[model samples]
Target: MEVPVMFTLQQFVDAPPSEVVRAFTEPEPFAAWFVAEGFRTPADRVRIDVRPGGQIAAVFVGDAEVPFTLHFGALDLPHHVELRFDDPAEEITVNLTELPDGRTQLDYRSVGLTDEQQAPIKPGVATMLTHLAAYFS
Candidate 1:
């Protein structure tokens, strides 16, 4: 049996689509904003290989150093990015659109989760996107 769980979240950032893409693709900006409140590390601690088959290795240091890898399935700069994580096997898609006011609208979707899983992940993604917006402000 499989649990059908998915979530879609939209957020508007006060920056261009290009800048939003850079935040997700580039290592330094990614490290800065892709963290939770108490789980941030220095930019140098993150490694991102921005390509279709590339990988992102992030180190989250709290009580201990926890490392994880996300593999990119597709990458279309300033437009879309699709990635998958191994441990629990989750797939995520990010789509960006430029609005007239020079801001970017982000559409984030994640699939392959249980109801128990979606509860926490949904809010976490929202918070991360909020941080992303703060990075540009």
Candidate 2:
């Protein structure tokens, strides 16, 4: 059996889970930090429906404009969320834990990727999270 290329990343944001979750569910905050350097997720092009079976759509504009839609698998507000990429086989799960110090611990995991797939995605995710942390700062 072929193993899926997967990765998990954790970060502590200096904000509560409610604020962290807002960054994920809100288009403006999402667009602000969801992209790597040289790429942009335009807030105007983002459409979000935050609920089970709902979807978020956005266009990542760089040298090319790539449109993608993520289908919501599960949404536990301010706590957990699962989103499936355009291909249902690929999914990302995000969990937020409330820290005692008024911060939030975020756990992010991506599964069902091939080696070729990880090349861009892994780095992109890292950059996205970095930008997210900076957004909260």
Candidate 3:
């Protein structure tokens, strides 16, 4: 059993919450910054319904293609999102708030992760933030 590991990441981007949130909700922006080192999302990626009860779909790269399914659970408009990654027994909740200077503050908290399981991804958040910085720049 994986023990819950409470982890939080905060990022301040040079864009309004609305635009940053839109980039997250849109498929093109998602695939570009969401890619981890070991995973690959297709170029033809398209996000289906992003509202509650919608499915986030993607196909892995190469011949050994594996499909992905993430379900949008709760959505609080241009502020928060709750979802679950189908292949993993995990839940995801992301929150965003607009700063006074047109900057967006993204905060994420994650649980249910084993040390070994999260070891590799410990650096992934930083990698992702770097991409987000470039993206919002």
Residue pairs clashing, model 1: none
Candidate 1 least-lDDT 10 residues: 33-42
lDDT of 2 at 90: 81
User: What overall lDDT goes with each candidate model?
Assistant: 0.85, 0.88, 0.73
Model 1 C-alpha lDDT per residue in residues 31-130, reported as the tens digit of each score: 8678865687567878888888899898887877888889998878889999998877789999999999999999999988888777877898899888
lDDT of 3 by residue, 1-137 (tens): 66757677787888877777765577776666666677766648656578888977877665466677778888986889877765445567778898888888888766666677667765886687667756888
Output the lDDT of residue 101, model 3: 87
Encode model 2's per-residue lDDT on 1-137: one tens digit a residue: 55678889998899999999988799999998888667799999999999999988999999999888888898889999999986636889999999999999999999998777777788888888888988997
* Models ranked on lDDT: 2, 1, 3
Candidate 3's error at 9, in angstroms?
0.9
Ranking of candidates on TM-score, top first: 1, 2, 3
Model 1 ranges with Cα > 4 A deviation: none
Error of 2 at 85 (Å): 0.6
Report the Cα lDDT for residue 136, model 2.
Answer: 92
Score residue 121 of candidate 1 by CA lDDT: 79
Q: Could you tally the backbone clashes for each prediction?
A: 0, 0, 0
